[model samples]
Target: MYKYDNYDQQMVDARVSEFRDQVARRIAGTLTEDQFKPLRLKNGLYLQLHAYMLRVAIPYGTLSGAQMRLLGDIADKYDRGYGHFTTRQNIQYNWIKLADTPDILADLAKVEMHAIQTSGNCIRNISSDQFAGAAADEIVDPRPYAELLRQWSSFHPEFDYLPRKFKIAVIASETDRAAMKLHDIGIRLRHDDAGAIVADFYVGGGMGRTPMIAPLIGDGIAIDHMVTYTEAALRVYNRHGRRDNKYKARIKILVHEIGADSYRSQVEAEFAHLQTLELEPPAAELARIQAMFVPPAFDTTAPDSVDRSDPDFAVWLDNNVHAHKQPGYALVTISLKPIGGIPGDASADQIRLMADLAQKHSFDELRVTHAQNIVLPHVKKADLYALWQMLEANGLGTPNLDLITDIIACPGLDYCSLANARSIPLAQKISQRFADQGRQQDLGELKLKISGCINACGHHHAGHIGVLGVDRKGVENYQLSLGGSEGADTSLGQITGPGFSEDGIVDAIEKATEVYLVKRENGERFVDTYRRVGMAPFKEAIYG
Candidate 1:
């Protein structure tokens, strides 16, 4: 985890003080709702249908146990007794009071955390692979590069107010775990033929009303030039991106309107100009950031095998455990989505429990995943059972990683003013429908995602079986899509014929999976089967 320096501390502290004053004025009736809107948004406060929601940033999805503990404390003390982990690897607290937010922010600042850039029409939190430092296949940890971008973009005068909000993701592996192609700017860090680190830039990817997978704008860019290249891409978007309608304001829209070739040309011109200015952060600074991400020390003699004699433990190991870069260690995903429960809501006690487990067994570090789960990145294989037991006891041990039960859903009409229908209940019903572990495992690696509206907050466009909740003539309706994926071979889902009722959607999903089971080839997952046979079979099964 990267600790904040004096400058970082001072900057966040100052923001807290500034936001505190703004909040007080709003409470005092000096600033009207319209006047306070932008100010509050800048600080990551949203006035939802019921109450204010505060989104706190967890940069690159990495944090220490102490910081995790504070998030638990905030959930317990400030708002409700639980918090919702989001697809962007951030946490949202609903039911926040206007006055307590400053205090909540103050508490966050103590642990080098803040809500800055978590919202607003600016470059939001830079995301990365949750297993960045621990993934076996990545060329190098991408967090240093992500941190560099974060430092450069924070409060950047040039991009403070873009045409619309911007999102950037950095990943080092070929297996895109962070949904890189679904971001405004996605950088894949890899080694060139000459053994030098290079970045492949993908620009204009996003999911909203107009979803798109970003095209590769530039490739083989020297790692030293990452910042300049990113600046160039943003400059192009900031210059020509639409402002007349918020609907078409994202860079994805601009890239779609102007051909990718023309967008690439413009970015190239900007890159050429930026190169002349030599605007990249110094090498020493990058080295400093990299030093912070060096792998944790491992016990050389740690046993390489786990005793999976317990059938339940074996199931969890198969479903939730991932291979680690280090020998005798494994990456464990704490599933926030228990059957018949909210997808990403973790109680304060559960949060604290995860923090304690991370501290005791996983080298005091934790990661928030884009799938809305938590990761214990460096747990020893020898200690797997003990860790599993602790997690299981604490309600954090649902062994559904990519299965149907591990649904990624947003807080839809229940909490969000923009939501057309209740996503939480739908997600719960779907998970409960397929609650049997044997059934979920048989379905295999089905990434189900739901969004309340077209904003795509829950990343519905990226799921293997995606559901979008809509208001149909004042009644809640759900639409299903198939074959969407957020991996290296990124693709947006195609919608099935017509919308369904809430219960109908659940049955529709079951029908879609039935088509997969019947049509799937050997070793094929649900998405693979859908892709192989196309949407016709699934649509027929669901609609009929």
Candidate 2:
């Protein structure tokens, strides 16, 4: 994790002070709702359906045990007893009082965290692979570059008020765990034939009403030129991106209007002008940032020594754990989507317990994954049982990681003001429908994501079985999509036949999955089978 220097500390302190005054004025009735809306949004505060929601940035999804403890404290003291971990790896408290926001920001600042850039039409939090440094396939860690971007984009004068919110994701590995292709700007870090680190840039990718997989802009860009290239891309978007309508304001719309080739040319022209400036950081600065991310030391002993006696724990280890770069260690996911429970909601006590477990068993670090789960990226395989026991006791141990029951759902009509229908309850019903462990295992690597509306907050566009909620004549309706994936092979899901009532949606999903199970090849995933056979088979099964 990157520790804040004096400059970072001073900026946060100033922001907190400024927000404290703003809260005072709002409470004193000097500032109306319309007047205070933009101010509060700049600080990551939203007036939700019932109360204010505060979104706190977990930069690049990295957190220390102490930071986690602070977040738990805020959840306990300020708002409800739980927090919602979002797809962007930020956490949102849905029941905050308007007056207590400054205090929450103060608490975050004490732990070197803040809600800055978590919302608004400006550049939002920069996301990287949750397993950035620890993944086995990584060529180089992407966090240093992400941190560099974070510093450059924060409160940038020219780009502060963009046409719409901008999101950027970086992936350093061959496998795309960060959903890099679904971002406004996605950077693929790779090495050239000469073994020098370089970045491949993709711009104009986004998910919303108009989902677009970005087109590749440039390749083999020297690592030192990242800032210059990124600035050039942003300049292009800022100049020509749609401003008249919020619906078409994202960079994706600009790219679609003016073809990718012309956009690339414009960016190149801008980059040519910036080439004369001192855009690259000093080599020493890069080295300094890299040093902070060096992997923790690990024991070389084999990981098989741990007892596999507990069948439940073993199932979790097999399904939820991933191979790490280090020997005898595994990257473990703590599933928040327990059957019949809300996805990505963790109580304060559970958060504290996880913080404790991270300090004791793994390195004193944790990651909030894009799939709405918590990750202990460097847990020794030997500690799996003990960690599982503690997590199970805390209600954080669910062996359904990546299973059909582990659904990714948004805070739909239940919390979000923009939602058309309720998403959490739908996720619960779907999980219950497939609650049998054996049944979910048989389904195999099925991803089910639901969004309350077309904002695509839950990334329904990328799930294997995507459910979308809509308001049909003031009644809640659900639509199903199939064969979507957000991985190395990224593809947007295609909608199935027609919309269904809320009660019929779960059956629709079950029918689709059953069709896949029957027609799938020996070892094909749901996506692979869907791609091979198209939507015809599933459509027949679901609608027949």
Candidate 3:
């Protein structure tokens, strides 16, 4: 995990103090709601459906045990008894009071975390592979570059008031776990034939009113020139991105209007100028940032004392865990998407227990996956039994990590001001709809994501079966999308057809799955079968 330097600590501390005064002034009526809106948003505070929601950044989805404990404390003491881990690798408290936000920011500052850039139109939290250093498939760790981008974009003057929020994701492996195509800017870190680290840049990829897969802008860009190249891309967006209609303001729209080739050429022209300015971060500075991210030492000895035969524990070990790079260790995902529970919502106690477990058994490192789950990235294989026992007691041991029951849903009408219908209850309903463990396992690897509106915060566009809620004459209606994926071969789902009533939507999903089961080849997953057969079968099965 990356530790904050003196400059980092000072900036956050100063921001916290400054925001405290701003909050006090707003409360005292010296500033109106309109006056305080941008200021509060800049600090990651948003007025939600019922109350204020505070989104705190967890840089690159990495958290120290102490940091996780602090987050648990914040959830317990401040507003609600739980927090929602989001797809952007950040956490949101949906029931925060306006008065407690500054205090919360101060507490986050204590642990070298803050809400800065978690919101606002500037580059939001720079996300990367949750399994960055520990994943066996990684070509290089992407966190150092993410951190560098974080520092550069923290309060960038030119981009502070962009047309819309900008998101950037970096993936170091050939397989894209961070959903790079879904970000405004996506960087793929790879090495050249000569074995030097370089980046492949994708720009204008986003989801919302107009979803677009980012087009490749540059290939084999030297790692040293990352910041310069990124700035060039941003500069192009800043100059030409829409400013007239808020709906058309994202870079994706610009990419569509201008065409990918022209956009790439424009970015390259800008990059040529930036390259002349000697703007590449110095080698020593890069080394200094890289030093902060060195992996923790692991115990090599595999303890032979523990039994792995416990049926319940073994199921969790097999489904909820992944292989770690180190011998005798594994990466464990604690599924927040327990059957009949809200996806990505963990109570304060569960959060604390996870912190404790991370410290005790996983070298104090934790990660939040893009699938909206928590991960202990390096747990000893031998200690799996004891870890499962602790997790079971804490209500965090759900043996459905990537199954049909493990849904990813947004805070819809229940909390989000922009939502049309409640997503949490819908997710709960869907989970309960297929609550049988045997049934869910039989269904296999079906990702169901729901969003209240077209903002696509839940990434409904990327689900194997994406459910989107809409208001049809003040009545809640749901739309279904098929064949979407957020993994290595990322693609936006195609809509099945007309929207359905809430209950109809669930039935529609079941029908779609049934269609897959009938048409699937041997060993084919839902996505694989859908891709093979296309939407004709699904459309016929559901609508016919």
Candidate 4:
């Protein structure tokens, strides 16, 4: 994991002190809510429905066990005894007090973490594959590049108040685990014909109201030029992106207004100009960042097999454990979406236990996934059973990876002031409705995502079973969509028809799954089945 140097520590500490005073002034009524809004947002504070919310950035989802333990302490002391890990590799404290935010940030500063840039119109957290260094199929660990971007974009004045929030994702896997196509900017670390790792830039990708899979803007860009290339893309968008309409303000909307070709040309022109200015970092800086992400040493003679005679362990092993590049190591995903539990919510004890597990079973490193799960990226095969025992005791051992019950949901009406309906309760109901572990395993790899609004916080547009909560009249209604994916084969789901009531949507999802099971072929997941037959069968099942 990357350690904070004197410069990094100084910057975060300074920001914490600055925000502490700003918060005090706001509380004293010296600054109006309007005046304090942007200031608070820049520091990742939001006045939610019930209380203030603070979003803390976890750079590229990488953290040491010590850092995670500090997060657990923050969750226990500053706010509620739990925190919600988000899809963008960040975490949220929903019950935060405005007065406590400064202290919370100060604690985070100690751990090389902060809430800065988690909100605001500037670049948000830079995300990468959760299995970055350990994945079997990784071309190169994308974290170093992602971390470099984090340093470059953090508080960058030029992009400080853009048209809207911007996000960037870097993925090194062939399978696109980071939902790369759903970000404002997606960088693919892939090899060219010359067999060198180069970056393929995708521009105008986003998933809010107007969902889009960004078109490729530049192919096989030199790794050294990634930062300058990104600058060019943003400059183009910043110059011509719509400011007239808030709804049409994202880079995706701008790319649509002007054709992808025109957008590409504009970006290239900007890139050419940037090159003339020699804006790209020196080779030494990239090497320094890359050195920070070097893999932990693994004993080559360690046993490669685990005892899976225990039925529960077998289930967990099959679902939660992933292949690693090293011979005797596995990537273990700690499921936060337990059956009937709030998706992504982890108790303070669970967080500390995870930290201990990472320190003991895996290396001292852990990662937060885009699906809102914790990952022990380098756990030894021999320790699987022992780790499982610890996890089961802590209620963190849910064998529901990629299954229907492993839902992704936002804190909708429960916490968010902008939400049209409650998402957590709906997600819980659906999870309970499909509580049969056997049934879920049989169904296989069904991603169900719920968003409280069209902002798509839960990435409902990318789910095989997409549920979007809407305000129909004064009552809450839920819309169902079918056949979406946030993978290598990315696609947006289509709405079946009119939405159903909160309870009705859960039943509607059941009906749609029934249709999928009846129509599916061998090795076909719900997504594949839905794609093969289109939305006709799902519409019939829901509406008939």
lDDT of 2 by residue, 329-379 (tens): 889999998889999999999898989988987789999998999999999
**Over 4 Å off, model 3:** 303-307
Q: TM-scores of all models?
A: 0.99, 0.98, 0.98, 0.99
For 1-544, candidate 3 gives per-residue lDDT tens digits of 7888799999999999989999999999999999899889988899997889999999889999999999889998986789989988899998899998988998999999999978877889999998888899898789999989988888888888888889999889988888898889999999899999999998888888677888887888988899999999898999999999989999999988999999989999999998999977787887888897787787877753436578888788778988888888888999998878989999988888999999999889899988899999888888888899888887889898778888888889998999987788889888989888888888888888998999999888889999999999999999999888876778899999999987888899999988988998899999999999999989998999
Model 3 residue 271 CA deviation in Å? 1.6
Cα deviation in Å at residue 52, candidate 4?
A: 0.6
Each candidate: how many clashes? Answer: 0, 0, 0, 0
Give Cα distance to truth, residue 255, candidate 4, Å.
0.7
Candidate 3 or 1, higher lDDT: 1
After superposition of all CA atoms, the RMSD between model 2 and the true structure is 1.2
RMSD of each predicted structure: 1.0, 1.2, 1.4, 1.0
Better of 2 and 4 by lDDT: 4
| TM-score of candidate 3 on Cα atoms, chains taken together | 0.98
The C-alpha stretches of model 4 lying farther than 4 A from their native spots are none
